[model samples]
Target: MQKNLLFYEKVNKRFILFLALVCFSGVLFAQNKTITGKVVTNESDSSLEGVTVKVKGSATSTMTGKDGSFSISAPANATLVISSVGFLSQEVAVKNQSNIIVKLATDQQSLQQVVVVGYGTVKRKDVTGAISSVTAAQIAKVPVTTLDQALQGRAAGVQVINNDAS
Candidate 1:
């Protein structure tokens, strides 16, 4: 009889421990809150999709949906960072916020800036020399591996010919 009682006591202890673990998991899941928001361009008032939305100081993040909307679950006091290419990054405090709308300002000055020439860099407003700007799309259209190879036949006044003789 004593051996049976000891076995029953061990089983009861394990059952209690399992119950406590389930309760703790429920509490943890309940503490997290969902945050949602939309990201738009400040200049054009257009929705910006696929933007990266991250929680500050945490490894949690999400990308904007097709309509520039995003949803993330985090603690109430977490802060969020919204970032995209060619736009100014924004940081938002998420205290007591269930929903938010962010308007990202375009870094127009970065797009309109001039390139460096010869020995010095000059802005587009102050440059008097002839300059040409090539975008990433233009560079991707060519099938060359090197800069010298891609520049061949693309520029009007530039010529590049490979010499094979040593």
Candidate 2:
């Protein structure tokens, strides 16, 4: 009788622990919130597809659908970052916001810029150093499978050494 009572007490304690774990899981699920939004171009007033949407201070991110719609689940009061090429970046406050519409202004000046030098990027007007531009058409004229092979003898100062000897 003493052994049976001890066994029952152990089972009861496990059952109580299981119930507490289930309740905690339920509360955690309830705390999750959903954020949905649309990304559009400010100038054209058109949907911008393939825009990356990320939760600020977190690694959670999602891409906009073909129609520029996106939905993501996160905790409440989270901040969000919306970014895309050729558009101004935007950060939004997500507190109490279930549905949002974001308008990204066009970065007209950045579209015409060029990257120069090895360590820095400069606009066309701000470049004080001599710059050489390489185009895809010049690279396509070479009969090579890899870009490094195509780059050979194309740029005056550029050097590409092939290390694949195997």
TM of each candidate vs. truth: 0.57, 0.59
The digit string of per-residue lDDT tens for model 1 on 32-127 reads 799998999887778998899999988999999889999999789888999976678999998889999999997777556967675588766566
Please give, for residues 25-108, the per-residue lDDT of candidate 2 as tens digits: 988778758899999999887998999999988889999999999999877888889998778899988878899999999788
Extract clashing residue pairs from model 1: none
Residue 141 accuracy (lDDT) in model 1 = 92
The best candidate in terms of lDDT: 2
Clashes of 1: 0
